[model samples]
Target: MNDIENRLKAIDFFCSGGGMSYGMLKAGIDILAGIDIDMSCKDTYEANVKNAQFIHADVFDLREDELERKMNLTKNDNNLVLIGCSPCQFWSIINTDKTKSQKSKSLLIEFSRFVKYFMPGYVVVENVPGVLRCKEESGLSSFISWLTATGYKVHFEVHNVVDYGVPQNRKRFTLIANRVTDINIIPIKQKGEVKKVKDVIGEHNGFPRIEAGHKDKSDFLHTVPRLSDINKKRLKKVSKDGGNRLEFANDPELQLNCFIGKDEAFKDTFGRLWWDKPSPTITTKFFSISNGRFTHPEEDRALSLREGATLQSFPKDYKFIGTNIAAIARMIGNAVPPEYATAIGKAIIKSQKNAI
Candidate 1:
């Protein structure tokens, strides 16, 4: 096929704010549409992803025939790519109320329905490692088995995003299935030093310092959650440049009632990030210093919305649409790192080229 004819068209399911779609576009993929239940993602997805329509609908309610009709998709199209990055909180290893996410556990199964009906040339799935650990419960095992049974070659493994040029040390389970041939998701080997927090964030990286509850004058989204007076005092006592709560352990006023005896447990909570190292996993509560080691290395407050998005490999110009800081943080934290998605897209293209 000629270059124009060989172009791959992709439709991203659960495409929250167009992270994966943006990266695929960066790698020369033609994104046709993004489907998600959250109406908040529509504006952001439509604005940043050129030539792609945003469909606000629950996956459970979306029928294969409806999707085929809406996107004009044909059965067994060799150049069609279906991307699924369903919400993985149910299978995430994080400590949370599982009951809230119980409904999301079956989303992968829902995604498999489209895969079976269309049998697209390429299929991609990205989720947390817990999905593999509890594959049966998450429907991942059956999905892989069905794909392999039907002549699709499948490859899946858990990989850290830092190895794929993302500045954060986020681990994700990735699966790539193709009917034309066996495919692989290769990590981008760094020539020298990998990216560190200092290299991509802080004053050196153009993110000027803004105090807690203050927004950067130039960017309104560069604002952090307000810390209470006690939390502010606690943060002041906590040393700068990657210090922990242990520094204020002896201080009676700074210590919390819940953490009196459990010094070793939950050490990451209310901790500062190391300047020279890659950041810990960014979560939905990354805007709060009480959540993980989200505090800025030298600053007194937690990361801003813009900083959180930056850690997730989003471009500076990418605008987020949300009602509040927490809502925006959830969108940023749950997104696939765009750089890693770009790498995946490139690998698929390389596989296609080799097959030809």
Candidate 2:
């Protein structure tokens, strides 16, 4: 049994697929409400997390009164915490074409509006490392300044997910600010052997071999890609556990466009994951075998949605709502790994105690 007062209450913004909320809940924090623009996330958020209210509203159009009412919260609730992790597609290094979009940059300003209006006791923001390079004139910088001006002690760091026990090499920028605490908070990387890809997948965990377009009934998000005949033959020539295209490309017909180039650096393309190493970062196109180093070590097809979710630290029992692969992949890929979130939650709880 645990004491209720020690549990913090939080509202998550841009809460896609409920990863942060799931972590907070696991750490004993009560998530009061989750707000996101995506309707597909509602069922997943509400179904998996108990007592969390889901609101499908654009942050730009969200009203103070409505949010307060829906959350059963008041402006005077100093114990409340606000978590904002807006979309990072605009600022990601992978999106080199800057002209493609810059709309999500405005979301930080919108998040700041809530902080200014509610004056919550604590605030947390997580996003890509590119966010740190965004100009001070940008909305993100202004939001940071506003939090500082409000007497909050702030801590921010760019960290790899693997440093915090997630079995993937994803990096993120994390910021935690608190109005009530004077303590300096830093996320402590657990001292242990780093987890590997083989430690996470395969039949040992009850995950069976799945081909493309086939959904696992037990794990609905699990969907594997069907392999083409040419790719199958290529994979066959490659070694059993750790083979790549370089091993099978002796046949002229098996060469891909990128493989023919002398200076190409994408060696991981069409590669198999080593069972003992951390998995690569899960991306939106994770369902496609050709997207990145997503091929299964022993299987011929790309990793299923459930495997991606597992790498993202989502529990096997967690249910995603969408029927289409794109929607499901977006939800899983966009999520903050629950393990990382739990670490953040524990830190916040520690800071709150020291504040007294």
Candidate 3:
């Protein structure tokens, strides 16, 4: 345990921006340390979670004992929990191309290496739903098999973030394992009514809006991309309150070339989100209207960095440190929403408390 108050110690691998750490901490777990290859996340992760240590390194380079020592673990401490959320870019159906490198596909297997070494009491894994399909042929199936063989009961399924009180329609694969006791991640009963886009990004929040490519000098990250002349004209044509480019597909002059060849080329691009519904999955390029349904319902431009983060369920105060808007967007979009992670943490705590 990290301290007297914590019932268990957790170490997260591929811990970008400390989303998992933050949520587990909220659920009262001791998130002892976090490891990631991206140095960019170091300041943000360290800045947010004071109680945990953050390590900047690839999982392949780390040894089990070194990780254990870094986490202040002893041989006798059986309450170790490991969180592995290896990069899912290669595993994502939408992102992966045939020519894309498969280097990251090995990370799931590498995570299993640590599991075998530490033999932790509890394990949590989060990734894109495509991961489940790949893992069976890749290493994830073998990993689950190993967990069951070694006395860990495992459960995993595709879960929507909105179902867990997040204000977005993002869906992901979540897995929880417990060697200390048999457990299942209880289907989260939503705290209240479904949150809507307006609920998250309504006010404009006193931050003056800027065009695309112009930085919000006053608030470092509350900035939007500068729209191109053509896109500006297109935005004018797009209807408000959940409208998209497809509304004028017949207009040859205004229709995008990419949409010309296909029967249905992602009509959601350059789309305005619905005010009453949960926002669509906020992607790295969400600041650009050319990406999926990112335009502000009433505004003529795409969402700002702050707006994107809000849609992803990051609290207003959750400071992301990065100069480039796209880089910061990547951080927010890739993160497991803190709300979703908190529910997982709560589940772990429940199982632990009920453990024999």
Candidate 4:
């Protein structure tokens, strides 16, 4: 916990596409490695990150001896940090099927196994807000209990991405626990106001419109959606900047299936985002017109993969790896926005410095 440069070494667990790793690297930490179960993430994680090793293995199966060998660390290494952001599909509110039977929740306990083994100086966890609401018998609760029992000072909060300057309204539960520092982990709003959708997307942003399956020449997995005839017509009818379904649906021919009866109260469906306002949270099915308020404010199609990434605060230079729209969209949607991650990283660094 020295204030000296390069005092922290971090290992990112469940590192999908290196979003957190990238931000930590930008914040001047040495990201030693990224570990995940998905083999598909290897290329993307390695391509965009610097000097960070990518391991393709389930956290449940990970062995401390193997990780230490790979990371070139021994029992003597101090100022080490372990970061885990386990998959939260089981606890996500957006998931219609809220079954507790999901095996993925077990990964939280797996993450704790590493923490107990390494007893790193600092620990960080990020997950959906639903995680904090999960039952005490659940893995998430047990993980928190384990941290407290180990005498770590833990701070956690549900935070909105917009509060940290991301152009999207994503809420997440973030926790930072440290044995070496007493610093607060909550993020301070960098600019005092959320960034607007228009502040991030469009032709000027350098992401051009591509057909649904067409990949970007430079960044192969980044692609835009092809507008269907019906949606194209619908978008044409919408007024510029912030018009939505209600404006055109007044015409009987343009009414959506959900517009009838009590559904009329749900205006966000088929809604267009105001240009000057932050976008709604980006979801896995964000490219489909019928899902959420993804429709372009002025165009006929849902927001494209590139647009979604931009809204998530990924740099224009960040390249995604994969084929097919689902693969790419899933990667983008599941990622922690880099801008928010950067804020978390900076806080961690500050805490480490203060510990000295």
Candidate 5:
């Protein structure tokens, strides 16, 4: 039994579908709430994480006093933990769209305000690594300076999630801070062995094999995107293990216009996933082969929603509560993979204990 007496409370900011909270809770933290601007995440977040209340509000709009009240944080001590994994589309290298949201860059500043108010003993943040490479030093530099001024020792690093036992090859920027002591995340080796796409979902037996765009009647979210017959034929042309759209550059009808002259325009698209390797980073449109290297190793259809969720390390029992495939996919892809969060939580608690 845990001898540490005070309630080990936590609040997750930008906690979509309670992914981070789920893992932290597993590490014995009493998660009080999850805050997000997306109202759609409310159902799934509440459904999966029972004790945590889902608050639908932009973080900037949230007053620190109100947030502290919701967390039931009375004494400011080592028992309180704050987690911030802000939305990171703007900081991502893969998304080069000119129309990306400009407002997302400042969410970290708002996170610092809450830290000042609650004076939590511990904090954890996760984001795309590009956040460290921003043009203005004012962005990340200012946040670090404030943390130091506020008396928190900070450690930030980029880590691949696969090392933390997640079955996908996603790299993220992570930061851990604590006023209680100087600390570092205990580096995690891949537990036992690196898990692959096949290990997570190859044995799942609930649904029958249906073509793309068709859902199993009993399982609504176990669905894949519909492929055109021509695209289906095109998929058949590529080898199962390491094929991509580039292979079809020689074929007139099958070739993509962007890749017709060049051998590879967007090679990851229409690419097959190797069964033994970790899956490529899951994106919001993982259901469509056109989105990423999402095609099943030996199957013609793109990854089903269930397969995508499994690759992201969401528990098999965890249920996402939306009907639209796109919205559900966004929730899964945007999440901090729970297994990775679990390692962070364990590290924080261990570090705190060592300090004592």
Candidate 6:
């Protein structure tokens, strides 16, 4: 094989905080650059990821020719890998406004333009399961049809991120298309290797016990959001570990007005995580107890930024750059779990070795 074909290189689209970039690098894939429009991601992406440049550009406006010129990519490069893990708020099942994601929903179509122009050796996509459920609406069906018709072997499926070694139970749609050989992208871990929350966090895992609103001056990322007086009182009454809001159903004082009549609904809200189980999906609002079962197993506060990042399989020393807690949480929650990405990268490397 020629040097160009022997060397596997990648470019990550919508790479937030360089999760996929860093993970793929761990598997020995050379990352050319990470492209994202969010300027907030630039510092974090550059700070933690070495050898890969961060390109600040909106995919919708970025022309294929410009990308090829900027990256010096050639058409039909068999060693090239193009990954498009676009913003999933539109395809997400979260109760968000439809209007806000109207423009983002068509990102797959935009990404397809690059795939068609470059016809890279491999193409990767990871997003919410809703993208597969609403394939036509999310432009996935069309993209798949095109890939198959163009002689590319394609495989797409919805996978629980926990199955790929992410400590959180996030379900995502993953697709890998290859023009050189049969497509095989999904990574498989050995049975009984699933990780639990206790394995990654808490005092046993080096996270010191801290009260609500405690901020470590040396490591500000370990800071937890402050709890209100009412929330604090309610949390004090709830059980320490794996407690749910249902305990307050009979108590008129602590019961939220929204859940009074609907006692059985939204049980995860204001709930504590189970120590022995994988964590619930970490959302963009994980710092707030009202969001999900985000409360620390023992601590009174919700998961700190560092804790959440750890749960997402980010390395201990990986740094995120953002002042606003909400914005930083969004970056962590939106990321493709680094461990899962590493698995995918390993699978790709295995495929390359097998082909030889």
Cα lDDT for residue 170, model 2? 97
- Which residue pairs in candidate 1 collide? none
Worst 10 residues of 4 by lDDT: 212-221
Cand. 2 TM to true fold: 0.93
Candidate 6 matches the true fold with a TM-score of 0.97
RMSD after CA superposition, every candidate: 1.4, 2.3, 2.2, 2.6, 2.0, 1.4
Overlapping backbone residue pairs in candidate 1 total: 0
- Write the residue-wise lDDT of candidate 1 on 115-172 in tens digits: 9999999999999999999999889999999999998888899989988778899999
lDDT for residue 206 in candidate 3, whole number 0-100: 46
Displacement of residue 95 (Cα, Å) in model 6 is 2.9
Each candidate's TM vs. the true structure? Answer: 0.97, 0.93, 0.93, 0.91, 0.94, 0.97
Off by over 4 Å in 6: 2-5
Residue by residue across 1-356, what tens digits does model 4's lDDT show? 22554478899999989888888788777899999988888888998888899988877777988887788765534578899988888878878675753876677778888888888887888888988888464476777777788777888888998888799889999988887765555655677667998888866666565444454556633556676676667767766666666776766677766675534675666667778889999988888766778877666667777788889888877888876777878888898888888888888778766666
Model 3, 1-356: lDDT tens per residue? 34454477788899998777887887777888889999999988888877788898888888878877776676434577889988888888778573563777788888888888888888899998988988775588888888899888898888899988788998898889888776565536477898888777765454454556666655436788788888888888999989988776777878877788663768889889999899999878888887789998888888988888878777777778876787788888888888888888888877777763
Q: Write the per-residue lDDT of candidate 5 for residues 1-356, one digit (tens) a residue.
A: 26557546788999998889998888777888999998999999998888888889999899988876765676466788888899988888878873665678788878878877778888888898988877253167787788888788888888999999999999988888888876555535555888987687653545346677777444436778788998998899888876888777688898877766776467888999998899999988888888789998877889888888889988877888787889989998898999988888888877766776
Error of 5 at 352 (Å): 2.5
lDDT tens digits, residues 141-244, model 2? Answer: 77777778878888988989898778899999999888786776666566788777777778887677766557665645567667789887777666656667
Once superposed on the true structure, which residue ranges of model 4 sit more than 4 Å away at CA? Answer: 1-6, 75-77, 98-101, 135-137, 207-215, 220-222, 248-252
> Candidate 3 — worst ten consecutive residues by lDDT sum?
202-211
Candidate 6 lDDT score at position 107? 92
Instruction: Tell me the lDDT of model 2 at 125.
Output: 89
Q: Name the better of 4 and 5 by TM-score.
A: 5
Which candidate's lDDT is highest? 1
Off by over 4 Å in 1: 183-190, 216-220
Deviation from native of the Cα of residue 177 in model 4, angstroms:
0.5
